[model samples]
Target chain A: MNEKKLKSILEKIHDKNYDCMILTQFNNIRYISNYAPTSFAICLLKDDPIILTSSMDKELAEKTSEIPVEEFKSFNELKKLFEKDNFKKIAIESSISISLFRKIEGNWDLNIEDFLEKERMIKSKDEITKLEKAAGISHKSFKELNPMKKREDGFTEWELAYELGYLLRKNGAEKESFETIIATGTNSSLPHARTQNKKLQTPILMDWGCKAEGYCSDTTRTFVYSEKQEEIFDIVFEAHNKAIKSVKAGIKSCEIDKIARSIISEYGYEKNFIHSTGHSLGLDIHEIPSISKKDETILEKNMVITIEPGIYLEGNFGVRIEDTIIVGKNKAEIIGNLPYSI
Target chain B: MNEKKLKSILEKIHDKNYDCMILTQFNNIRYISNYAPTSFAICLLKDDPIILTSSMDKELAEKTSEIPVEEFKSFNELKKLFEKDNFKKIAIESSISISLFRKIEGNWDLNIEDFLEKERMIKSKDEITKLEKAAGISHKSFKELNPMKKREDGFTEWELAYELGYLLRKNGAEKESFETIIATGTNSSLPHARTQNKKLQTPILMDWGCKAEGYCSDTTRTFVYSEKQEEIFDIVFEAHNKAIKSVKAGIKSCEIDKIARSIISEYGYEKNFIHSTGHSLGLDIHEIPSISKKDETILEKNMVITIEPGIYLEGNFGVRIEDTIIVGKNKAEIIGNLPYSI
Candidate 1:
């Protein structure tokens, strides 16, 4: 599987006339070499890619990396090797820090590209299986938590969030993909409110995910009680449903965002609908081809994305609904069978 | 406290003759504004520092930020604001991505500095209070876990790590400072080994920390059984003790590292000790002035650091002992009352 992935990346490097691609992002390195670095490490991708890791990571790298591993000494040593190999142009990840970029920009043309992200946008059958498993575990854990009961029992926002995390881990998730957001009542008006110690309130918005085999699953559900809250929830549910339904191979991602935005706009809550419709996910919780107004990346089969639409009424309350979906030839397949409503 | 922090940053900006210092790092923003952004945000440090946060973060930012908050529209809008303000020179954090640097690089002087890190190295009284509380909770929870009994019960490495995480949160930690490292038997030889599903084995090495009030506390302990393992553990403990004892205000951090390295080297395991002696800690787990051979940063009063030394024998096992300490005029004060020997 990695060989095919490497082949595509190599073809891109060759097309760009670059000698090699330097990947410092942990996920990118893991995608290419299967060695997820715990500390600083670099993956130099070429015909025969090699991972240069710290001395402390040499043992783990040797054990896990499919590609060859070597101990990284210093940039000076790496520069000497590049000079010896007569390398000139090299592709680099855009996430590289400017300080590190300056250290290696001496005698080479450093062309920044999102080659790994572009490659990762299209998941393989194995990748989709991992995502499905992650989604399954997350949904199963959420069901086990029974948020409805917890809310009735007067659980604090943090307690509910912590319980969900415990359930996720117990059900085989390595950990949460990101910090779980559990906003309640007026706090829900803030899209990314920190889980507070206050008791559960009328409306509860939870956006959470967990990782299974390095793949991430993200989903959000808002439980509402008041009539007004339910009204907003229904609008967000409509946007979420339409957005996911619009996903298909060969369509622009922005179009899906437009579909969701238009529905909320028609309800006169366009300004209240903050944030992107959704984002792609894999090893990392957030990836390229974000479902927003600006991204124009064409959707492709095997791509996994989320369709999350939210309506936040500042100082009052908010509602959001989300699900992970796999792009299909003519439609979209939701990853898990979790119910959209409470 | 935030006002004081902002004042210091603005003074530095004025001294450099820069119009503003753009901070993208979450910790820097939190340090200067008391608002930790959940999404993308920027802190523009000037006479009247302001934070530009995403629409999703505007509510939370408004509620938490000590400085004024504004909704960020786009990078082009920001460029126009800078042009309108006649800003010519700007300072940026070293961690800013090269791509972001490029976006705002045109017709302006961008100077990279570690101003925030330097300021953060010296902890305030309130910061120390938070760190001490974090350490107290971490040590108490470690005691509660009773790893000695967990080993007898034959728990898996990951299970033990998970249990510790549960204890930390239950004891009032926001979360783990980093992923808990619970490497048993030969796996412990890897300094940053991921917790595995394998049953417990001899020489269990556990490195863990927790966050309290946004501050972090880090500590490591190894449980050894065999005589050979005890010998290695003793050497590591000696190095750890001497390193902590040598810390004081006005000494270079490298001197403390040398004290620890020389002790380990005398045991003829210099090569076995692969990583630095220690590192500073605060809101972020790893801070500045790493206690390594090359770092000549002068230690100052109120600076909190860790003194951790380890010996890793490939294909065998590893032993590490760590403790967080506060630099004093004459000596270092270890934070928690946890015993060195378990």
Candidate 2:
């Protein structure tokens, strides 16, 4: 972020009478310092921004951080720093734990603040580039997953998940955004089934992602075999398609969800559509302004989110199709080039 | 995980005047109910315990949870249920976000409580068995790695990590507890260095672990090929050994940290010993009563922790030795049988 943007954030924080802010969330820290912490790190944003990082992270922080970095010594020493500063009103991120919050709250007038989250909602050009790269890597890796080879040779669910992870990393991703889901056979009936040590079964559903330069990519594809599977697949696909088509700058996030749900409801499978239409993705796999019925946040330009719609049949199978789209002025631009149908 | 034990926990919460407790943080939920949520789940502990789980997690929750499970419709719906029950004082786990706290705080009187954490601190026989199994799988996987194999045909940091993870899963591990850290060459100097796509170098420092039955196991091995590496390794090994030896019921956790620090200080590398001596581990990779300089919590029987000590030479290399141990009545019982020296 530019100095002006950072200063603007500080000004907004000041309007809330926050003399100091504690940022522990890695992504929030990265937004200000340009250094994503590998281990534990804390940033105290006051008159002059500073980062206290673990000794192991010092080298990396020094190399990447725009702000001055210090080796974190002890919590006692950290507590003393706050005392010395005499910070009366301290602002903390919502993600800060109650345990850690109580430890620090005893000494200061700490208030929960969304100052960082508000700033992070609007993606920078560099952040967009990283997200694009992550999406590209995920898409490329998906194509490389020759499931036919595994199907013939009899590969286990976890083995396929592991192979996809390896491919994602090999394709320039730093790591997977989350655990790769490879639910197959009857296990595919569970929307979030654990991978078992068994051979891949019919109508496989794989939900996976990759991370590049700290940005995350999320996508899911379900391969159907039986006619019943195909029938459910078409409804999910239509929900996915209509949801993606409904994306625009002025539209509320929930409207996108309605577009998906309306299609599934028309098929008399509204109850079968288990999860939300989608969720915003960036440094974190799940972010705010989710495409759920209750969320009324307006979709804005540069807001990247997943458009996933699924229908699950109890004890039978499930079908889900997902894609990430970056919101543009008039419409949303899909990030990956992979086809919805395989 | 017995009904009586669960009842006691509920009584403790009631004693603290908590009408209902919202449990997130997967491990905490698993500790209360056998079910570990894959997606999202919330256990509201009151007169009648009920788990509100996402549609994706319903099947798994139903299969594993001892408590009654219901589909999570929306936050508003959950709030309505709380209102219907006339719950006035709601307790929340410390792991909950400040945003979530604020969102729910408006509905009832909120207080951060460790009612569940206190219950989890003392493990039952079944929990210990699972932990031991996790440790066994991790040890067997490490033996299979045999850093000597990498010496025969050099491997990239990530490739070695991938192999270790694969081996762990092959040996019946549920999954890796966390990302396998295989820092070698100059990268070893930084404690939490990201693995690079390059051939392995001398003085390889590998920290790896795996999960079994929801319990975690952690271990680290450093390969020394030169005199300098051996010298640093010896100091770290002494610290590691002394720390483990110091672990016993009724002893202050920080005392064990002092033992390790004293060893490194005696070797004139006090400043090089960067992080804490050890940390408690179970379902979570890092847990409470950290064996740090300031922690005054007493060690208890059946508590599992890792004793890791390291010495670093910036831009040169680093050596670290780590092992998981179970705190017994008299001494620490090493969880894994992996040799310190390689």
Candidate 3:
């Protein structure tokens, strides 16, 4: 099923004078072989892909992978195999650890390549379906938890986070896409806040998602109480709305970020919006082509991304609104029906 | 204070003619500065250490980090700073990404160094106390879970895993050290099996842990139902007990592995044991000085590690027993008072 994707990557490697590509990221491997390793595994994408996985994972890999599976012995052994095969060039993912890079270094040329990233950027119909399903499950779970009512009840941030996770799984999600962020009151000022044991406070912020069939969904909402909190929330919500409206197939990812950032800046809260406006998400929550000032990747049809705009007053409180959307020919398609200011 | 730890690392770097070390691993940073990063951040160690964190993390980092904190702009700026400092040799952790390694490659001599790993190998009294508490909390939570009774009641692996996590938080734990593995019946054959929605079956193998005060505690226990399952369970328990008994200061780590492997081999189940005997744990669950045939590091006092011996029969069932222990001069002190079988 991934023949087209593997062929595309192989052609890129060949054009770059590389014999094969070494893929270690679980999502990258899964995209090719339909087997996401639970431990160390390498996918050698060449004329015919082969996966070398730990012995503990050998059985699962064999049962699920479209490619041939082998039990990994050592880097020394893999280096010898490459030498024996007389492979002239090897392309490795930029995410490879220096330790592994050093271990696999040989006489052959080895360099970082983004062939897999380029291949995985555009979502297929099957992948998009999974993404929508994951988003649906997340929305259903969030609604069931009812943050508006939960905010009044005294419950620690972690307790509510756990309840959301339980609800997500019950709604048919495989697992949480990432750690549920249940930052409350002043803690919400940190974009990536750790869930605490403190009871619920005003301006509750929760950024949570779930996985369905190896696809991820990301969403964030802030429940405001005070007049100031509501005012900040309105500004963030405006930015989030405008950014989503600006997404299209031909526009640059950074352009979308600029749209949201400019909206926040208009209200003198530009500096407070700390992180990127959004990021691409698929099997992994944080993918390439981030909606950031530094990124200039052109948005493509079927590309999934999140637009999260926030205003954080250091040591005071923060308000954020986020939603996942899909790039379209003319307009962006938001993933779920979750309210912006829930 | 981490003054002594910092001194040790600086002395090692000085011996290697390195001016400063760039560290990004959250645990290593936390060990030195008492501040664990929630997002992208870097700790530069020299005569004076400074942490360059994302703007979103600067407020928390400044409050928690013992060292100075600065907002990170870009790698180009960092490289310019390194050049201005006239650094002759710069040290980096082996775990650094090839992407980051390429970003800061400059006129200065850049090389992989293990100063942080070497410094973190030995635990302090406070770290050990935290580890003990984490282990105590994990044991208490597991006992309260009453897995034996849960086995009788019909509940999916994911459901029970969620409940265990809830109990872990209730008893006092920052979070799970790693993903809780709740494998049951045939799924137990895969050592690192994913927690599934399938109901609990015969021979439930759970490998779970929790974090307390940034320290980790790992343990595993298999509840067996059938005669063959009990037989395998007995052999694994014996190997686990013997391995724990063999742990002490001044012995090679491989020697302990040999002891465990020899027993499993005598029982004709050596091939069934796929992974290492155990691994060291501190802020991170898997640390260096692994109890494996290839690792020959000498055990030292104040080192915390786990002794887990498991046997997996593919397509059938698996059993494992694990415990965390502290290496003393002439003995090993097991972390908690959990029973081998329940």
lDDT of 3: 0.90
- Indicate which candidate wins on DockQ: 3
In the range B234-280, model 2's lDDT, one tens digit per residue, is: 88988888888888999998899999999999989998887888888
RMSD per model, one decimal:
1.4, 2.3, 1.1
Q: For candidate 3, what is the TM-score?
A: 0.99
Ranked by TM-score, top first: 3, 1, 2
Question: Would you estimate the TM-scores of all the predictions?
Answer: 0.98, 0.94, 0.99
- Model 3 misplaced regions, further than 4 Å: none
Question: What DockQ results for candidate 2?
Answer: 0.71
Q: How far is B212's C-alpha from truth in model 2 (Å)?
A: 0.4
What is the descending lDDT order?
Answer: 1, 3, 2
The window of 10 residues in a row where model 3 chain A has the poorest summed lDDT is A1-10
Task: Judging by TM-score, tell me the better candidate of 1 and 3.
Answer: 3
What local lDDT score does residue B4 receive in model 3, on the 0 to 100 scale? 80
**Residue B89 accuracy (lDDT) in model 1:** 95
Best by lDDT: 1
Off by over 4 Å in 1: none
- Fraction of true contacts reproduced, model 1? 0.91
Model 3, residue A305: C-alpha shift (Å): 0.5
Task: Name every residue pair that clashes in candidate 2.
Answer: none
Q: Per-residue CA lDDT of candidate 1, range B229-288, in tens?
A: 999999999999888888899999999999999999999999999999999999999999
